[model samples]
Target: MNFLRRVFEHGRFGFVLLLFVLMVSTLGWKIVDLHVFDHDFLQGQGDARSVRHIPIPAHRGVITDRNGEPLAVSTPVTAIWGNGRELQAVRDQWPVLAEALGQKPGRLSERLEQAANREFIYLARGLTPEHGQQVLDLNIPGVNALEEFRRFYPAGEVAAHVVGFTDIDDKGREGMELAFDQWLAGVPGERQVLKDRRGRVIKDVQVLSNAKPGGELELSIDLRLQYLAHRELRNSLLEFGAKAGSLVMIDVRTGEILAMVNQPVYNPNNRRVLQPGVTRNRAMIDVFEPGSTVKPFTIAAALATGKWRPESVVDTTPGWMRIGRYTIRDVSRGGQLDLTGILMKSSNIGISKIALDIGAEPLYSMMHSAGFGQSTGLGFPGERVGVLPNHRVWKEAEIAALGYGYGLSVTAVQLAHAFATLGNDGKSVPLSLIRRDRAQEGHQVMEAEIAHQVLRMLRAVVEEPGGGGSRAKVPGYHVGGKSGTAKKVSTSGGYTDDAYRSFFAGLAPLNNPRIAAVVVIDEPSKGGYYGGLVAAPVFGRVMAGALRLMNIAPDNLPVETKTAAVVPGKGGRS
Candidate 1:
């Protein structure tokens, strides 16, 4: 009995000792694993559940005019974002959240269910900070206000087509915004942050990447000039009851677009109301037959061949000519007009005779050198190269039609560029929408003497009494320009009777031209559809204001004022 009791006690003690050693071994192993072998791994696993790497959005750049006037800027705003999984748990607050977001509860619920598998989703974008803050104060699970920017156009419709607008994610959609997107879009950053179970950011753990703000874009537009152009174009459209219009003002010396305005403009801030036609930059994109505006180029081509001179005369006594079953007529019988008289009267018969004399090659070369049938290299989006046919394929009738501006097409910018070449003394410079620091090298397209002679003739068109462009004359300034009225081409194929595109292209201060401008009024239904009556007055008004604003010295003396000896008041008359 004693031996059996001793065996039982020893077994009990051994078992107790074994249990203690096993407990000590387990505790020691756990300590070693946590403090040495698997420390980083366990910590990383814990952090994965509570920490997040988030993106820090970089601000887009500001777009300014040449004078440093802000056209487009990024305004600070807040966006409501949410974690779908966490947001789903806050069903009770869904109605209040929906009301804040301007959505119905059912819609919000549906969206959450649809996004249940998504980590992130936008609840609302482009909310004012005050409104976004109110939502954040609700403290609904997973709901947060993220810092963002909304594009704002200070000039509104006056500069909308040039500055453009960004999409919901701050990506450029149109205009200069799209053209220089990469330069205006900055690099985003990353940061590691600690988040709570409810998906709220608790603290920033570390910054992984630094945000680089976008670079500034300075354009060649002059805001004052742009506003003037916009106002005048708008007024002209209203006065003439036109379907659409466009005006482009360029610096003759540099080929920089000082102002570009299009009628039927849309506000960039209101994207919902934007239409495709209203959003198009018509000055650079839309092409039309230039009509009589192209006569100067034809005249230049004739002069370039040394076959025509300012005094050269063409007989238009009958006012019409037949070219292979096609009849070309003049507005009236010009009756043996000179080169200058052809432009002054806009005689179609006279110009066609001149073109036939010069042949197709010379005329085509002049048009091509003036920047037709090619891009202007402005890098604008959707810019069209106006159509000019190959001279080799031209028939005799086609060549004659082209001379009077019917067989080809040219954009408003191309027309302005061609006139600018004339204003620049026969040198054609590349067009620029961005401000250029140095003078650009120019291509000598026509002889300086010939260009000057054409300029003189254009002056007669405006300054001379009862001329085609008489309405374009500006007091105290020698203005030179041409008028054009073209029948609109129909969708079915031929020209429409009542529809017309009126055009006026000109330069100011004829002696030393500073500005070149083109005004085009499409399908005027009220007042008049003629370029001289409709389009010329717009150019004259806009140019007069622009010249005054730029402080250009008057090239012409004021109407000789008769200074009558100041007869003192009637009582003091001597």
Candidate 2:
């Protein structure tokens, strides 16, 4: 007790106690600072190193034909990525990694070097699950896989121009894919994730939002008919050695496009050979002078005047007629012919005389009313509204040219739409790429009687023995069609003599028209370039298959014979 009192009195015990108190206070203050004042900062730093909000990939919509056949689909795929900073540390393993990824070691190293400062970098994208799993099994540092979707086209190049294609990120780039991208692309979700230092997700903490999957799109196209058209058009292109071609088929009842195809197509699945010319949707985007196909509309124009009938005579004693500096000549002698006979012969002089007499405004009115010089309202990307010059003062030659389906331009779809209007009793219906629940209402563009008369005239062009469109006949169907071969306009100014655009536009089963189609072949280098020879045959085969596929009854089927029936009671002679 005396020693303890001595120590306390000397201040040594108090000094030791003060030192202990100071040490405890410093530790307590440090604990408070870490838990309170510096808590958010520390937590934020940790989160910056390990916590992440990653995107939960949303799948693109499925595109289907009218019959519910899948055309375009999105398949789940795995893409490999890495933390460039971490990957740089594992440079020795890059050769093995590069081999598994089917990449050159040198290239992989170079890519990694370029991205060494990045926290995240794509190593390999669009990998199959098995392939990605194999890479992950190696357990290479900094390597990770993310879920993604790759667009797959089942139709390949056959429907490439129609369905279009998507980019690496699954965004639409062309065709209906680009046209309805918003509707087809869904909203991606967000999720909180806990990641490691190497950028691999260790845990999925929580989903901030749910992914909304894209909606399904059902197009009006019939896959069967599309295949048929595609096959027939491709054959014709090969046969004629044509530079390019386009074919369009429409359901006249609903104005729904059954099939639309273009040549020089590219595979949406393989885009290595993608070029603007190869991927062009020519049926909707490109235009050419329709040539003589417009004669039906001119006849309709004449009929609308109330002065000309289907049987009205036009004197064309000479085979040629001079207008301005150009001379219009017929292939055969143009005798005195009624409108029907003139259409059958496809006489340029005869049609020209009718046009010159009717004047320009009337012909323009007819063509304009037939859905020419306008968009088809299909909402297609880059669709051209063909040029129909509505010049206030029309030259005499221009008037004649308009009568013969020249001096203006039209797309294959536009020409098909016009013929569909004639098949629908002169009502112009809106063209559709999407499937319609029912037939939409249309406005009458011509008198029903006048339209019927024009249909009969068109029938003469196909049914008559010497008709130009005789090759377009379906075996057991009464078809009405017109053929046109227009000279391609030269880049300098005048028309090119060697280059020609062949076209055939018509509807099948004239009695009750169900389908209307147009075929246009650009620059047929071999065989023949005439519309009847090059385009009409294609139209015939495609239309025949289309009619059969749709189960349309043949209007020209031979009449059934009545069998003589003798009842068993006839023996009684009642």
lDDT of each: 0.91, 0.91
Q: What is the TM-score of each candidate against the true structure?
A: 0.92, 0.92
lDDT of 2: 0.91
Task: Give lDDT tens digits, candidate 2, residues 198-257.
Answer: 667789899999889999999999999999999999999999999999999998999999
Model 1: per-residue Cα lDDT over 166-233, one tens digit each:
89889998999999999999999999999887788899899999888899999999999999999999
User: RMSD for each model, in Å, please?
Assistant: 5.1, 5.4
Candidate 1 TM-score versus the reference: 0.92
lDDT of 2 at 158: 80
Model 1 residue 226 distance off true place after TM-score fit, in angstroms = 0.9
**Local error of candidate 2 at residue 504 (angstroms):** 0.8
